[model samples]
Target: MVMIHIPTHPLVHYPGDILAWIAASLAGWWQHRAFPRETERLAQVTPPGYYVALALGGVVGAWLAGSLNTVPSGLAPSHSIAGALAGAIVGVEGWKWLHGVRGSTGGAFVLPVAVGIMVGRWGCLFAGLADQTYGVPTDLPWGVDLGDGIPRHPVEIYESLSMALFLLAYVPARLRGRAWARDHGFHAFVIVYGAQRFLWEFLKPYPKLIGPFNLFHLICGGLIAYGFVWWRNGGVRADHGAQGSALSVSQPDDEPVRNLP
Candidate 1:
């Protein structure tokens, strides 16, 4: 079995960091132009300390979850996108609650973050078997040979493609002033991504957290539940104006609302 090996450089070793920086930059640009008031509101509502707290919480949470999930299963404990995402969500929510800030601050991040994940998965795919992100064996024509002789499902590619499809569907709907897409964009992404992740978890070889579900499956379930509850409890209404109306920053003196970020 001739395994495929890609030589690593400094950039390759920190793909996550590079992708995160890109995502942050893109999201900030979107917010600055599309939702300046929202940005200003966040600056006021979310303290400087909250950023530090969120960063620390995200790192610690990712490390802890990754460690727990990998070490217990006899795999080398390493960083995982799932763990980082889950940790960031928890950290931000905790900080929001502590600061009494309500509504989703993640609306602007939906597209950028999705793009980042889709790009980052490429790194996982090329990392080969050592990264532990490889999938189970498969006879499918397009199956990848990740250092193993037997062809295997390219699960990372599957996830990246799924996210790409999601962006295709979501971006158009959001651009067209779709009611649900405009008002509940963040929750919409969460629900869709969570459900997709839940389905894809079955293809992974991670140890089960319950009977057949793994830790990531459980995390996906939690995200789905949170997304549902958040939407059900009128979270969308709080952020947007009228249903079907384009989302815009609040302004004085009755100027025309700008949509498209």
Candidate 2:
């Protein structure tokens, strides 16, 4: 069994997070231009306050759920992608309901968020056991020594690779004007993420809140359920199917969409 050695330090740990955010921002910019007209249309209906609500919800949920799982295990509190997703959903959906907005407004976020997670988990991998994202000890040939003598499952890489594969399939689907991708891409992302995360949690050493289930497993379950319901209600279009490829970013917008909200 070849063990992978990763040196641990604050610099090693935090830079991955910084890079992840930067990458996510770039991806968002690219995706925004990729579906310009759709962006405008969605924005016109989306509340300006939606972002604010999402931020608030994400922060609160990240802390609450992350700490809920980690602190009980006597580990330092941290944030969770799963919790952030849940928070963003509650915040955005609650805001949408208040403003009478309908349908999947999350289309724009699908790629960027997925990409963010892909990049962010690497930080956890290098952050060593302090990041609390490490998996249990494993004797597998590919196990990693994250500054700890015991080789453990490289779960962070597993998550990052999974999201990367998702982007490969998802990005093409939108460009090809696949209706399922356009309508339900975000929902599908949530479900896929939740399902994958749920499976991955089983390998982690986090204290289980339920019999054989950690806090994240429960959180992932909720996310999967939410994704299903939201997709059925919002992403399902009874009106029409794909006319053609959505407005391509390469083509100029008739008018630059500005301050839509």
Candidate 3:
């Protein structure tokens, strides 16, 4: 089997970071266009300080989670998207509770977040060994050499592709006005992301923390659980105030994912 040589260049790596954010912006804009009113409703009910909590939580979570794994592994400090996601949820949820706001407010984030992850992971892939996100050596046909001569699983690419594929399915289903997609898209994103990450962890060379699982495995497990709980708490089966009693949205079968505020 042929192995591909992946360039380990800061130039290659840093550009992906920019492109990822740009892609997220474009996706967010597109989604906003697709559902202007729902977007507006999400905006109106969203506390002005919500963004602040999300940003702070994300930054801290990324750093803290990455460091916890890398420092112990004798690698330089790093940051993780998974950690950032977890942290952002904690921050936003905490803020919402304090403000007495509830329901699935992350609907607006589904596309942007998925597209962002799909593009951002390419940065990690190009960063190579220095980035410390590479997987264990493998004899697989698609193995890549990221500066190292040894062929290994391209875990970063796997994650990026996973998100990309998810978007392909989600967008079409969402646009078709699927009830489940309208109501629980964010939770689905969370659970799928977590599940995929959990599987990929096994391919990584990170030190095992519990049995054969690593730190990320634990974090991913929590994420999966969180997604289900959040979905049940704010989903179609939700008892009341899925929108915190201030506002509630209902989708119309006649309209494609249309939810009037």
Candidate 4:
């Protein structure tokens, strides 16, 4: 990897530093997009201030993950993507629990993972092969050579382009109706992405077996299977018998609070 040093003059920031900032900003935007609207109430809760808080949390979480070498050690695109994904997942979910979101709300549970991976993959592409899961050697025109007597496949671009297409498809599907959302919406994206990422892992240079089994392969297959079944079976099954009165939460307390005229 080549590191270019920038003089600390007024106008110049180091390239590495600049890339980090850009990736962080993109990560923030991507993470924010997944916030679901619960009859539009989520908008009131998740404003610019909420996002600012989340971003700061993400930054800290990512730094900690990096220091701990949470996955693998490298300044590659894959690591960047992974870092952003990990941070966003924790940050978004933690924010929801902290805010005391009772019942189900849109966006809080699943969007962060979906959107974060979708956007963070670009960072992987720009960061180059050092962070890639390159494929087996081939004479096919698109193979990349990352030294060590190896010519690998450009699986990074393949995954990115594929996800972009899928995300486009998901947008229209989400806006159609509640039946679409309840039945097959979230699971569709989850299953597809899981399958894609799992298949793409084969092209990577990392170990196929993390422990007793192939972790990437297992997760991909398992999530896809689970998502498919869940979608076909009506997604999350809420226990109506256990549910409490909604009015109690929505209504004012015994002592009346002052309201604007």
Candidate 5:
């Protein structure tokens, strides 16, 4: 047997892992836009507040999930948290400026962010820190052995799956002009991601003592509760007319609703 050694040093491997995956995912997302069917419709679709909310939520969620916890498990430490926040703030504004205050999904904002996460988490998994740690141990064949005296759940995989499913749900609903598609899609993403994250946190090991629960769990639970309340309040769709109807961002008088059915 040729003696084969897995690289024991994390520093040697992490940068490439994160950089490559992130770069590739971004490239793929951008490339997908090149296809007219996938790219053109988004142009007309003005970015609603949901985009802004998700970006802000991601920053706050990522930060609280990473920093307030007993230890870091994902990409970027408190510093990454700062960077993520700054990037989101700047990115949204910059997007507004570039695309005009009337923003459109026609660009590469949403997909790339999700893709970047998918890539970045891989980095965390390899680096073996940050939000990468979590989930109950499983005897399933796919379980990862972190060599810390236990076979752990691969929480990152769970997140990646969640985001992927969200994107998948969003794209179709967005295109067909589903009723409350944008609103439900965006808010649901937040609520679902938050809830799943909270549940997953239960399995991971944290440094601080929080009576069997962590900060992320509480926050997620809160968001999920809010999501439920939010949905009950007629959801994002209630604010608008039915599907295929023009959404009057301004006062209804401005749009001149003609014989609304």
Candidate 6:
């Protein structure tokens, strides 16, 4: 069994970050083109220092989650994508609340985030065991030998594929101008992505924080809950608006539609 070795080169260590930056830029471009008005509104509502807070939160979250998975005895700690995502979400949401911003400004990020993850996972895959992003042992024909003699499930690849499929489905809806898709795109992405993560987490070898579940499982659950609640509330509001419109149409013919002089 040939075990994959961690690259000793400093430049090689940051490929994931580099790819993620590129993905972010692409996501931004797409968001600007697809939802210029919403994007502008978000800029207006975003408070000062929001980006700084998000960066700090991501660092802290990555450290905390990474530590939970594997903490070196004396060496600097590692980070986890899951931790970074959760931290970033918390940071952005906290900022939004402080600024009294309502609804999902995150809709614009869904595509970019998905694309970034799909590209970034390749970095983890190539990082070998040092990245701690590997999956459980597997005998499947498609299993990867990540420098290790043992063929593993390649969970990162699975996650990337899942997100890719989501984007495929989502892009069409956005193009078709579906009301729910336009309004609650972020919520839909979160719910779908959370479900995908929750399932894939089961295949990972991370230590369980609860019975048969790890820290990521809890985070996925929270994401799913947030998405579901927002989706349901949006639906209810739409339904009520439709009913009100119907009621207005049913008004007596004698009654004027407007009060004119």
TM per candidate comes to: 0.81, 0.89, 0.89, 0.53, 0.57, 0.81
Q: Write the per-residue lDDT of candidate 5 for residues 20-126, one digit (tens) a residue.
A: 46675765565465445434434333356546754775576556545655335443444232234333544554555554333123123445555555565555555
Q: Model 6: per-residue lDDT, tens digit, 30-109?
A: 76887677566555545467687778888889889788766643334678766777788789778756754445556667
lDDT of 1 by residue, 24-44 (tens): 578558646865664664564
Q: TM-score of predicted model 5?
A: 0.57
Q: Of 2 and 3, which scores higher on lDDT?
A: 3
Better of 3 and 4 by TM-score: 3
Q: Which ten residues in a row have the lowest lDDT in candidate 4?
A: 241-250
Better of 2 and 5 by TM-score: 2
Q: Sorted by lDDT, highest first, which candidate order results?
A: 3, 2, 6, 1, 5, 4
Worst 10 residues of 6 by lDDT: 242-251
Per the 3 Å backbone cut-off, how many clashing residue pairs does candidate 2 have?
0
> Model 2 off-target regions past 4 Å?
235-261
Show where candidate 4 strays beyond 4 Å: 1-39, 45-83, 103-123, 139-141, 146-150, 181-187, 208-261
As for model 2, its CA RMSD to the true structure in angstroms is 5.6
RMSD per model, one decimal: 5.1, 5.6, 5.2, 8.9, 7.5, 8.0
lDDT of 3: 0.82
Model 3 lDDT per residue over 100-164, tens place: 55466788899999999999888988888888889999999899998869999999989998998
Per-model CA lDDT versus the true structure:
0.69, 0.80, 0.82, 0.47, 0.50, 0.70
lDDT of 4 at 70: 25
Candidate 6 TM-score, C-alpha based: 0.81
Cα-based lDDT at residue 183, candidate 1: 59
